[model samples]
Target: QATAMSVDCLGQRAVLSGRRFLYIVNLDAPNEGHRKISRQSKWDIGAVQWNPHDSYAYYFAASSNQRVDLYKWKEGNGEVCTSLQGHTRVISDLDWAVFEPDLLVTSSVDTYIYIWDIKDTRKPTVSLSAVAGASQVKWNKKNANCLATSHDGDVRIWDKRKPSTAVEYLAAHLSKIHGLDWHPDNEYTLATSSQDNSVRFWDYRQPRKYLNILPCQVPVWKARYTPFSNGLVTVMVPQLRRENSLLLWNVFDLNTPVHTFVGHDDVVLEFQWRKQKEGSKDYQLVTWSRDQTLRMWRIDSQLQRLCANDILDGVEDLIDGISHLPEPDKTLHPQDSEPQHNSGHGDEEALKEDFLNDPLVGKKTDQLGLPQTLQQEFSLINVQIRNVNVEMDAVSRSCTVSVHCGNHRVRMLVMFPVQYPNNAAPSFQFINPTSITASMKAKLLKILKDTSLQKVKRNQSCLEPCLRQLVSWLESVVVRRTAWAFCPTLLSSL
Candidate 1:
């Protein structure tokens, strides 16, 4: 029986490990092209993963008993590379680094996490002692030197520079953790699935508690972040049923799944998202099950579009007003004495109906009496506005809006002159203190000013385009700086 499976980063092939043999299938023609490579192992394979950095290398590792066997694919056959031999106990999980192609991390039941340089397999380059025996390990996608390990009911985050200690520890669940993964877009965010029948999202920077929790009646085998969005996919065994348990959820809203994939007849051992093909709008989800079969589920444009809308809608519900608290509080506020509508506390049903009836349902920027062409272009930007507070000054013909992006907040103050959208340019300034560097802040302001002047010269609206440019700059800078800072000193030491 097959116990472990993984898809390569390029999504061209998949590898499945059984009791004493490895099977390789070309995803393009899965059924017609299948090859089996025999291995000398008495027990079943525990875990497997392909090298995620290089497409031409085609290297993979398979763990069994107390050792991990490395293999390279060439001409439809797997050739044995060196076997890494350091763990005294069974190897539980392994992962390749996102930035460094030769770096690999492995966790074992020996209560240790080992980082190895595949080029020199004599011994592990770094060893981290864990609080308990680890069952899973995953590298952060947005951070090069940061990684996480799951042991017992807790998850630990480690910086490669300080291998002797963990940077943060979170008591995630009451039972053993089965899976752990970092968010693709955010460096501090991560998700964990446990045998305790719940999946929780956490921000390591704020370790006091989890951000969100999704409770299921059955054990969730794995929970992973989607490649292109904030959605999550999980494989679980439903309360009384043992089949068809793949579910997709919007992390912001746990009330319901956006879609459920139902094709597998037995418990799914592992599943991965295939890289989207060129010019293809749909994404493929591949799964291997205990029923001795592999299946692929296609998520079309309609479903993806719905998932995106659902994310924005959920954010609107969570943070519609400036004073809206993320969590409910029983303590009364002074503003509660005023009328509900004026105080931004209208009926929930009425708010929902208003959102449904709004003409700008899927738009990023709200209507501001701009031209039709300019309005459509501004709406096409793919940025999520967590919260917005607009202050309008009719006497001065000015507007100040505070926008929230991931962990960074920005405030924009624009003053429209008497000859706006005709000849004179609007004055723009960034008011709030952002965590970004001074140089980045200056660059953003310069871009905003330049764009505003260009719009004025063309005799068009400027606020919408300026906001869109700001969002784009914020996202790019955050992702790049965070990933660079995450590379530890140990990488240089090596």
Candidate 2:
């Protein structure tokens, strides 16, 4: 199997592809090396390009036989977690719509490019057949609705919202279009690479035009805009070595190459510009070499913001959970056709006026965006947590979580409203833990290791029995339960 080729960072989590598996690292920890998150994958992690949003996110893989599988990495400890299904060939490259989190685009060797509604992993929402030999794909970041692809000798763009070929070109290239990428900050600016040993830039917004071409003797295998940085491009070339080399490009003047990096002897197979933080242009840079090395690069200078096509060093947090934007609802997150632009200049004022009138704006919400309904049910809690012996029994038929804080002799319960008629009241709930996080869980585990418990010892493989016994004793027992109590109020705050 191929060694890990690329690893992309998104805040604490970094998605790594290689060894026929995906590894996610919550790098935010003080000792991230000790914590590992991984899963075997049925997809080929490309030499460059990791998921743009979440670390577990993956769309399309290089086809081993006939079909490419796209997946959403599920982080819980459960079977049937990872979601997959996409293109029918080696998924050469893919990208997700940023503004709309649920949309995915992919291109493959089968000569077909497709889009998916990751919101529903069961099926592909849109599929558009492309030219034969088409093997590259990239989404226009400036316009998530648009996608571009290159095949044997053509470069094409399609409106994802449309079914027919809205934009096409037969005379776009003289040879196979090997690489394609769109500018991160600008919608019209695009870069293309070819087997003809040349890299070219184009501005699609300007009546279908090619801005400039930079000559190169090597095949440009991958190219992309450095996430969040201004006017920077990182390209991977597999010419002299199977590993790869970094080529810096100036989007304003693509005809001239500014810098070429030569650090690895083997093929430099994968490269990713660290996302987040503008000042850390060169910070968090990562690359894989065939020589079995996954090295990190830090920008040498802080004064210089832009160097070559990569940002300067030390900038991080670009992937820190997209700036908390005022979204209408979760529905808009994955399939929002477009964010409603401020109708007039005083959008700020307009939003303030609207927010003041929104009934659910500042209040705690239930599963249906309504106030949490109150009802009582003292039923069974039967959700099992695998080998961990951690389970969430529906203490009642309602949505209530019982958190056991090992120390301080304290336990808290956050319960939600009752399920309504028609199974359609749609009680709004965030399944993600309220008071507990992965990091918090990890810390508690560490504490368990240090504390006195039934199963305390070295190299004891299973802690389920011990943890279950501890949790059973620590559960908060309230005799009389009502909706108007502190438990319900605290539950709604979550």
Candidate 3:
């Protein structure tokens, strides 16, 4: 049951390994021009990967038992270029260096990791000795010399220049780590999924504490960052052999999965993102399952938005405005630590009492005083009222609402005070192009103010609630006026 697969970096080809052969299929045309190379091997292929560098796009490596065979496929013909033989036990994983085409690293149960130069396959060019065998290995995408290896529940960071010892150690998980992935943009950041039923994000600079954690009920087989936005894809160990275990999460807010991928009849063995094409907003997720089927899921811009943190964009602008000031304290005190989502939020009142105390809102209150929480609310607000149009500007702390109910068009500007959502309400004022009567306007304004006050007293946002109240009242007033006119006509006819 050899079921290893890898897609080339160019996104043009994919190779799937089986017991008797390696099937190479063109991703652009999966059904045609497919070819297979026969290989006689007793052990299953444990891992396979294509060279990530563009120049070496035709080369790939597959490990069967303890030996890794490097294959070259070009012009519809394929053959084994060379084979590396050093590990005493099964090879667990291998990775091609992101920056170096000639460097390939492999981890094995022999408790030795080898960095081989394909030019000389006689033996490994360098060997790293460890007490426990590594289950996974990956090169840092942002740094050429940095790499990481996972041994049981621990992780070791290494610099290729220093092979004598690991530079840093992280006790990442209590259970065995099943997956490790380095962040696309940051070299210091990485994610690990473990059998402990949790995926934890780590900033390796601070090894003691994790940046965040995503807890699941079942063991996680793999968790990897999306190539596009702030999304993460996780494949959980299937329970009962029929559960839908693939889930997509928004890294910033791990409250719920943004989407779930269905249709895999069996467990997903391997999954990888296709290299994004130039000038395209859509992404393709390629997954291979034990059901013996390969599937591609398309992610459009709309679905991508669910994974984005809208508040971060506005917060970055606020941070830039105060660049001249001294940097904020980097030391994270126990009180200022990250709040775990699974734990109760009873103590969160102290940190979230006001916008100024918000962790993401930042300490630059003197410069902009804008709260990122407000921006996030605007992005997620539902504005589907029948005759209402709202224009919200979180930066200015104001929203303009226009409503049309029967010949009356009311336009008002609602401005929030500085102490908003902390027992301070917004002010509502009617603007030009308002065709409503004085009595109607006064009644509507009173209702809006009361709605805002009720929510603000409880330390909650009031913009969306106020808009909904306005629409509900306006519709009721229109119905009453229509009923009065109909009553007079009915009496005259009788």
Candidate 4:
């Protein structure tokens, strides 16, 4: 049910990979002029990608089984131009070089990564072996020779120029990596999502520790950087298989997603950005779901602003506002503007100085050392934790947390002060429906108070962590009681 979808860099068309066919749709008019190319294989396409060059706009690649097919489409006709075959096992993923139109890379379960030249489909031009099969392969957008591959929990960085071994290695995760993405602007930076229920950012140069981590309640299916602003898009595998899980996040503020895209009745299989057209301020996100539907959402300037980093705000505003300014008078002769050119150059320096001096320009940033607001913390809290329920009222600065473990039930009111999470802890009160005794309630209250104090002293959000602690404590209590109740009977039977 998970189909692969790819949008061409030109943004004029998209290709969807299906079990028995490949469907190419005109993005500008999705309901019309669509063509489906039949696949004669039992193996579904594992990965699909469109060539990132404008000149090769009609060219795309799809991987099936151990082979990869290159498709060429023009006007109303489309067909497979060639097939690249070398891997001994199933090919897992493929990617086209961002800087080279003729080059394509494929990774396989055969423990080999092959780089193919479309001009010569007889054999691979270069092959790199990692001794372990790779689940994903991605070409660096900023560097043509650089590529990265994910092998289980580890990542290997490769430079095509030197194919003998990985130039750098990172123990990225403890579980299988589901997705790998290179930063659009930085060559050494990348993000890896895994079954470990977290997405970690890496500089690669310093592999000992991650730059930042985004903890999630469910495994992240994919994490990718947006082409505009300091934004990131993540696809999560929710516990309820078909729940809405597409989220748009600000990279600067990782505590919460800026917006969540809801509407898909089933899980989203793939998503890609529609190339932003010239003179347009809006970007579109195209997604394909397990429900067998394709949906596109427009991201206007207003949404883009929410993802903008404070340090980049001034630059983004300058670029967007330049076109709105009136065009200079072309009627004036070149000789008539000589004095104005000199005066204008002088004014430019003064304007730059004034811009820098303005207090409102590039002065605010995410690292302002301020604690998060109650509403922001509430937005960041995970509501899907098992056997736990939290009802938060931001206006009242209070929340009711309920946890059920075995036959025990706990319902408590957690009230926060005005200066919460800034050396100010919330007070927990056991309420109706609580099944624990007075001694147990007091113990739980002390644990909750200590947990909240630990985080508040550091000016951090503690509500979610405290809730998780409550669940763990209750489960331990239940397990101990069950063991004690059955221990004597087991010994007598023995």
CA lDDT for candidate 4: 0.75
**Candidate lDDT (C-alpha), each:** 0.69, 0.44, 0.74, 0.75
lDDT tens digits, residues 306-407, model 3? 555443433343332211111132221223236355311111011212332363544532223222366655654555545888899988988888999787
Error of 1 at 106 (Å): 0.5
lDDT tens readout by residue for model 1, 163-273? 999999989899999899998887888889989998987888766677777788788889998875546899885555544557776554454455556544578889998
Runs in model 3 lying further than 4 Å from the true structure: 312-339, 342-494
* TM-score result, candidate 1: 0.65
Residue 448 lDDT in candidate 4: 78
Over 1-494, each residue of candidate 4 has an lDDT whose tens digit, in order, gives 32788999899888878777777777776654357787788888889998989999889999899989899988867799989999999999999988888999999999999999999989989999999999999999898999999999999999999999999999999999999999888888889999999888887887767777778888999999998876789999867774454777766556555555654557888989998989998998888877666667667664575566543354544333311111111111222312111101100001222233452553322222222588766654656556988899999999999999899999999999998867999999989999999988886786678667866776766786578568756764664355311122211221
**For residues 144-240, could you state the per-residue lDDT of candidate 2 as single tens digits?**
6777877775777778777566475534457777667777666766777777676666665432445555566666655665554333445545655
User: What TM-score do all the candidates reach, one by one?
Assistant: 0.65, 0.52, 0.66, 0.67
Give lDDT for model 1. 0.69
For candidate 3, the 10 contiguous residues with the lowest summed lDDT are 343-352
